[model samples]
Target chain A: MSISARNVFKGKVTELKEGPINAEVEITTSGGDKIVAMLTEGSVKSLGLGMGADAIAVVKTPWVTLLAGTPQYRFSARNMLHGTVSSFVKGAVNCQVNIMLPGGSPISAMVTNAAVADMNLTEGTPVVALFKASHVLVGVPV
Target chain B: MSISARNVFKGKVTELKEGPINAEVEITTSGGDKIVAMLTEGSVKSLGLGMGADAIAVVKTPWVTLLAGTPQYRFSARNMLHGTVSSFVKGAVNCQVNIMLPGGSPISAMVTNAAVADMNLTEGTPVVALFKASHVLVGVPV
Candidate 1:
């Protein structure tokens, strides 16, 4: 179907965890980055998710957050990918920063222009992209 | 900088419309797709937004909604794109569905597995992805 969401990664199911209300599945993208997705227990069973299953991790760009500098404190986010500022798209209210991960995978982040200025996210700035596992959607090939 | 968002689109501001409380800015991606973003009026001015400025549109996956069949009723969403189902990764509660746009752009979406079966979204299923412009996060490159 047609949608505006980008950031789709084809991955493989490396592990699966089932719970009462929700379940989590870990998928390793083709680029070697692992993504975790949480869904309902019924979905896990109906999807026949198992080890070594091919899957696609669906992450929206907005759900992906960008950080300018590294802090010593720990956060609750489950996913963190490191990369350099690849590009910048300035908008009236927000700016889009592209963080190029180690395998040449570029993760895009949207932040306010004020935040961009406050963080000084320019080209080549080292930053981290963070997102919650629940924000990740995993899809298997038909 | 290092917050919890990813998926950034760097584009040029082709249009800007300011309302009483909120404002809408349209950015054309390098690939030529124009994405509309809505933010507060203060954000628009504080960012020094104007015509033909560079900007970014940040959108989270939860802000995205996927639909398989075409409906007769009109909706209030600001953006909608049509594509074909490229794949589906099922989870316990939700399924990640990837739709391949016309330009080979893949847009990912999250839906329940029951919705998947209800919509019958297999590979190659025609569907439409919809989202409101207000859900988009706007930013400028600092």
Candidate 2:
């Protein structure tokens, strides 16, 4: 089936930490980008996930949060990628921003037109993308 | 500022979408699931999003899709959460399905009676909840 999520990264499981209620899985993409996912203990067991496992991390675009400037406050989210704005597209209410990570990974984000103007963002601008570990969905190939 | 999204979970940017006019974002919730949103490029810039930024991803309940049984096909939606039916309330046209994620977080989905019956969903039945990145709304704390 055609999935609605826009980002799919195939990676290897580098670490697995299990808790009573949840579990955290770390995936290292071929592009050298690291993705961390938090799921349920049951999911971890059901998927039979372990270190060195080949897994796929899936993320949808709208859930990506954009940040500018140096982050003054530390965030609880696990993933933080720094890159420069490579391109963008404007729309009636929202727009798409493309950022190229230093590791050669391409990331995208959707924001409002008003926020774009407020931040005065443009191509070549430095930015950050944030994602919480729990938002990541990990699946093994069937 | 307050928004219309009924589901608001604080997380960071995990994935993003690049589109002609709009973009998709994927956010990992603290409770160990991801949410996707579609917005304009302008909104992304205005919010100053980067990886690791403390942001809140929001989704309206109606935007959530529910699926039962094991997924035989791949879906494009960014957020696919596997959980159990905690509770539900039926209405004339739409019914709400409350799913309990592994981390003790609750996710609510609005589906049709036909779908519930078709899926044979019950209080303890396992199900998958889906969200497209475009349907998610990303925001940074002011």
Candidate 3:
């Protein structure tokens, strides 16, 4: 079977498997790549990635041919911020947001109870998450 | 305070996150660059990035500098047949192994439960993750 992968996927989450403290999502890509993404239990609930939920997966291949010859992720004085809410952790006060960056990587940030109430952040709310380039840690393979 | 960033932390995850889903980690570089990394509930434990945990982080400049350079990840068909395991995920009855090629990055393959039992796979165990250059998909930033 030929597996066609795209840079981004706009699809619905078909299945959600919740382990004791971990979770996995099955996303049916537009091109039909049954992509399975693992997330923390908190993230699963935070993002509300429930069955038949619509979501987007942005893939970044910085070293791949299309983006090759470009500088890899670098830290600088310039402010660089990017992330996507991949999952959620339901909290008594506020829910935690699991943010996935460009590199098929994920990060976690807490949304204050007030902030969540103010922004009314939910599964589909497109809230812009920001961070400095300095916040990113780059690692070369050994 | 100026932060000098470097890519030095590199290792396979031996554990994963526990509770709260999202936790923030600050890394003080040798040059005193306080790099902040987000740990998702799903990955925190698996990454073993606990207090004073050591790993390599690859740092480049301009973000595009690493992209404008030649492809850092390259693999030969023959070498793919005998590569090391860069990452793995255990399924109900089988396991998915992400083989680390000669260069950085990884390719994933599925192995049966028996194979995993026979190989006695562990976190640091090396197994070749192989794929063709043609398998790589490249694209411009959207």
- TM-score for each model: 0.53, 0.54, 0.29
- lDDT-better candidate, 2 vs 3: 2
For residues A29-128, write the lDDT of model 1, one tens digit per residue: 6777777777545557766788898766666666787776658767688888888998876656656676877865667765677988888878898998
**Rank order by TM-score, top first?**
2, 1, 3
Worst 10 residues of 3 chain B by lDDT: B61-70
The worst-scoring run of ten residues by lDDT in candidate 2 chain B lies at B69-78
Residue A41 in candidate 1, Cα distance off native in Å: 1.5
Residue A94 deviation, candidate 1, in Å?
Answer: 1.5
Local error of candidate 1 at A100, Å? 1.4
Model 2 Cα lDDT, one tens digit per residue, A6-59: 455677899899887568999888788888888756568877888998887766
By DockQ, rank the candidates, best first: 1, 2, 3
Model 1: lDDT to the true structure: 0.70
Expressed as tens digits, the lDDT of each residue in B11-35 for candidate 2 is: 8888776555556677777776666
User: Could you tell me the lDDT of residue B20 within candidate 2?
Assistant: 52
DockQ of each: 0.05, 0.04, 0.02
Docking class of 3: incorrect
What's the residue-level lDDT of A31 in candidate 2? 82
- Tell me each candidate's RMSD, in Å, in order: 15.9, 15.2, 20.4
Which candidate leads the pack in TM-score?
2
Please list, in the order the candidates appear, how each scores on TM-score for chain B only: 0.85, 0.82, 0.33
